[model samples]
Target: MRRFKLGLAAVLSLLLVLLAGCQAIGGVDVSKAVLGTLDVKSSMSKQTLSLQLVPADGKLKEEDRKAIEILNSLSVTIDQAILQDSKHMSMEGAVQFSGKKLPFHVAIDPKTMKLFVEGMTQPASVPLDMQELDMAFAGTKMTDETIMESYKDIFGFLLKHAPNPSSISVTPVTDTVNGESLSLQKLHIDIRGDELADLAKGFLTSLSKDQEGMKELIGRLYDTYYPIFAAYAGTSEDGKNALSKADKEKQINEAVKELTSMLNELLPDYDKNVKELLADSPELKDILSKNTVLSLDLMLDSKLKIRKQIMDLTVQLPATEDLPIKQVKVRSETEMWKINEPVTVHDVDSSKGVWDVTPGEGSPGAMLRHVDRQSELYRLLKDDLKITHKSFTLYSDEDPSILYDAGYEPVIVKGTLMVPVKYVADQLDADLKWDKATKQMTLTDDLTGSKIVLKMGSKEASIDGVAQTLSQPVQSFEGYAYVPMKFITKALGAEGYWDAKELVLTIERN
Candidate 1:
């Protein structure tokens, strides 16, 4: 899952750059280029990253020394990918680390997101909704899909008033990537270290002067947040208004109008403030204008799908006797293909570790509320993860109050924690069966192939049918069965730890 997260981070960044640069650089039509990246559907990609450290006048930190020795190079390859925007994406490939290739398949879909390694019991999966989990005090009108559309509008406005792209260019070119020959368009930029300060100042100056454009963006943001504030007013904490719903709506609209008028009044001074800020920050300007170089080459297929990218960043410090560093460089190369095509991610044949709990009707808890008690997700959530809530709490005591049904919980007996059946099931793969009439319990350990049988109110149990005396009888409480922790650990070849203060027992499988 961590690997999938890293891959997803890289994908989001790459796509953001693609979208932002659509109308940014020269030699491209604004209308066509702005939508260039949106046509992408699926692809295959591989990337290599290299970082080099240069020590300087002073001795480096121990961690820095270790990094130079152990963390200099890494490579990731996505053999198959589906990029239907950022959230609906998937990839399958291997990561090169420590001279070994670790294969992985990671996917984020509208219904599910999953990560699968080569030797895992099953693919790690979760029910995913490609929408924001609005857990706000008073929920906003903004949602995942809406925010994406808003970002597109915002980026378009930004590019409209941006500095002309004399520094960036696009040219027709032919290139072979990953042994595939193709005709491509290369959008390239090479920026010197000293040019960054001027670029920043120029961009800010341009933005400050664009009153109409800035007003449009500000108005859009107001629309986004207006409903949120109004909704918050209906909640307990923020509710001060006694107005009816219709009256509240009118009042919020009036407030927005007044606030917007005040904000527009300040736009006139924005240009002045930008100038003063740049003038006041000489040290910041010096740092940006020195010791750094950034260059990028992005390739697009005939369909405007971003196909390959190469980026290099180099920084060199002007080291004195007291300086700690001299020069550092980082570079990455990525290539992609199979655009707008069907893509398949990793799947598991066995449902051992994989769980899909996206069912039921309402909120996230609806799944838990309606889950079949016999299902794997139910067992995992109720036993292993120990999640007992149907909804998230906004606020809670430092030590949360635990609620147990039928007064069912673990208790200590003879200085040993006699845990309930649900707690014993936390081994994850432990198979449990009960005979209601006889109150006989059977447990099977998958890892060790060991079996145990215990009868209620009996101190004698059997390990593989061999009778043995337990630490104590399988104590019964409030119609809930309990077994001694010491006997369970030894019988199953597991280790146990009892936290007396917490009155809980932890079992470790061998």
Candidate 2:
């Protein structure tokens, strides 16, 4: 009986394991659950100029026939050409481009063998024969259909093969220039974001309950849906210029206002929960206040400026310790310009390594034992000369011979020398040591008792027994110390080698 019970238990355990595996592998279909509305609209327009040609005798001649054939060939070529607009909207992804339907337009006059072709902004005309005219028109129609089908295919892919029948309307209009009326065509498409969102929600709700999977689905849908919606809502290139900064700001403000109003309307019931969450997360208060930006700037200047400012900001959330609330805070100001500039010197002692400076607009002289004009430390002092604007001082407290480390090398920035710590230590023959207990790293000279200790997140340094200051604090990566490589090798009498082509650095002791 005991053996039978044990066997039955084992069988049950195996079934349980199988069931758990199934649950994990076949969790909710995230694409269906979290994806909310996707709306897209596309407009394309083309204008073409045509020149008519006819036989002087008003009848078809052999030469006329050949001219017609040439025109026909040109027409087919033009008809097959596809032109896409610069503007694009991508959401969970109904991708749409600016302008009206039929990316390219072809016009043909069979009797005259005249051909006209139009793309996004340019128009071309040629004379063609009846056969060429027919072929061109057919090719144009097929091309338009293919483009539309491609759009649909992309949208279908984003919607996870779920079909949402779209409503399309095409109208032909005429415009008169000089004495002749030209054909103008417009294609309009309307997509509903709410419908897409509803579809996504319904799909997700029907799937097995998997909160994590559902959340992931929601994120994916968000990424897919926005670009499509934005493209559809914006004006086509032919119709309007790109949105200006003021216009973008206005739109963002309006969106925020609308969101706030909605939240206000719903907050009455959820206030208690929200208040509790906020109370439990004091750090989020700062983030909620200062983290608002209308758009992410893609320009080089804007990107660099924003990145430099935000790089030092860190948020730490309380985890594994307390309340189920979100906490965010800017934990470091090390990168702040004000904080990083001109480290204060406590003593004005006229020492070889000591330096003084006025606040701005003066040259600063840095004193060192052995100056390698090619080294990073030399360049740093040179660059600082412009920033300080006033004559500053530098004291080399240690033997200058230590600068001859085999692991020291120059860092290039914009083809100029800069210093990075990781590059220096690996170049020198000495081992770089990181002490997590003290959040410090030590570069020790294997031949001498001399060592330089760098504290993470501070510009302060301790070389041998003397405390010194640095222009910049040491940076850390993955809890490891990263120092200015030049400083490490120079302090250790090591040599540094930087292979620019391969972007590798080696450090070895002399």
Candidate 3:
């Protein structure tokens, strides 16, 4: 899925560049390209992908033809599109497989990055930092120069080396969209399998030239970007600041030297390994030596911008007697446009996460309101538990004033309020340590210097070296080790109250 997204993005970027370049060179207009109605569609066809490519009157030898037959199968398409004056855009896309359809859509404010979905409480505003976003989307150092440099490397290579089709044809046409008839230009391009294979072989051959230059470039890139990458990766070598420039350079040199040495040592066996692999997989060799064809069609407007594109490709799979499936077909289409008015972004309260929960918003009993209201426990405790940032006071529904307090966030599991032992220790100024080998926890109250030990899957605990029985055993679930809220607070010199009428257990500590 990640690769598919990246490939799609590349295709769109290529189209943008092609359109922009054509406009730059000729009578085409791109004044409205800054923002407009846009639509996109894409899909893969399983039927075409599995086709057995064969010519009507040709031999089947692997090397008999310069071009081998590849699958001329699969049928996929993306046809729906609507873009109203820049403020609103709507499109539907789907992929069909095994008689099932996977569909998705996109609708949002392009200017302010406000997202609107069909089934959402409200539109979501997306915030982004320019430098960080550049690094994330472009996959390079957090600088405009580095971002553009990386883009150049990608687009330049693709523009220079991508295979040239065997033929290209253009025609004029007309189509109706949303009841409006518009003149269109259509383009068709054809490519052969042998031409694609030659392109791939040429790419590999070019890598052998300027080995020393490539090595130096790699070392320089590593030395310059490693620290930035490490910061993004959330790793640090020392407690102090990052490495000095000299230190980073030294590390990069060592790494490059090691890599070069390893590659050189393995170079002698490279040809032999390739021969052995081909010898063992004759079908792979045969497939590589075969011929295939790809056809691409594009529909454009008067401005010479693409409105839609269709690709039909065919290739032959290796002959396998055991598999009944052979021929495969694939088809896809995309459309985009510009709107008159841009979608507006509404400002919203950004306060969220840890700071969003006030003194009572996320308290132990407070969260119950958001839980399963149909539960018996919810019915009983709905009005009995008092909520506060520092504690939950039950039965009396009162708050205990404290000088210093840690907070506890409570959750309900199996109709019971489960408190994390760590949250308790944190709120009451305590230290909690775990022993993995014994599956035991040791918690000490910093205020009173009181200590207790609780073991996993055990109902018994030791406090101040004295064994004590608990109402329920300590339990571990979903990577969190927990104990009953009532027991742990009581054992730690805190107060625990139970309201039989309300069916509530509240712990208060200061």
TM-score of each: 0.52, 0.18, 0.38
State the displacement of the C-alpha of residue 486, model 1, in Å, after optimal TM-score superposition: 22
Top-scoring candidate (lDDT): 1
lDDT of 2 by residue, 429-497 (tens): 345687779977787654455778888788789889688776546654443344554555567765556
- Residue range 1-510, candidate 1, lDDT tens digits: 333234323422333243333353445554355454544545556676677766765678776665555444445666655565555666667765445565777777666777665544456566765543455523555665566567666666655544433357788889987789889888777665555434434444555566556556666665666556666556432356534656645655665565446435444454464345446644333333446666778787766677788988877665555544566778888887666666554443435556443444223233344455664545544554445422111111222123243223546565655666545554434577898899899987544557789999999999888998877798667777777766776765556665545544456642
Candidate 3, superposed: residue stretches over 4 Å from native: 1-149, 163-187, 206-227, 233-279, 289-291, 299-305, 339-510
Per-model lDDT = 0.58, 0.35, 0.47
Better of 1 and 3 by lDDT: 1
- Candidate 3 lDDT tens digits, 109-161: 33333333222223344432444454453443445445445544444433332
Poorly placed runs, candidate 1 (over 4 Å):
1-26, 30-35, 39-44, 57-63, 84-88, 119-122, 126-147, 164-166, 177-179, 220-287, 315-328, 342-352, 355-510
Alpha-carbon RMSD, each predicted model: 11.7, 31.3, 17.7
Winner on lDDT (2 vs 3): 3
Clashing pairs in 1: none
- Judge candidate 3 at residue 201 and give its lDDT: 32
Poorest 10 consecutive residues by lDDT, candidate 3: 40-49
Of the candidates numbered 1 and 2, which has the greater TM-score value? 1
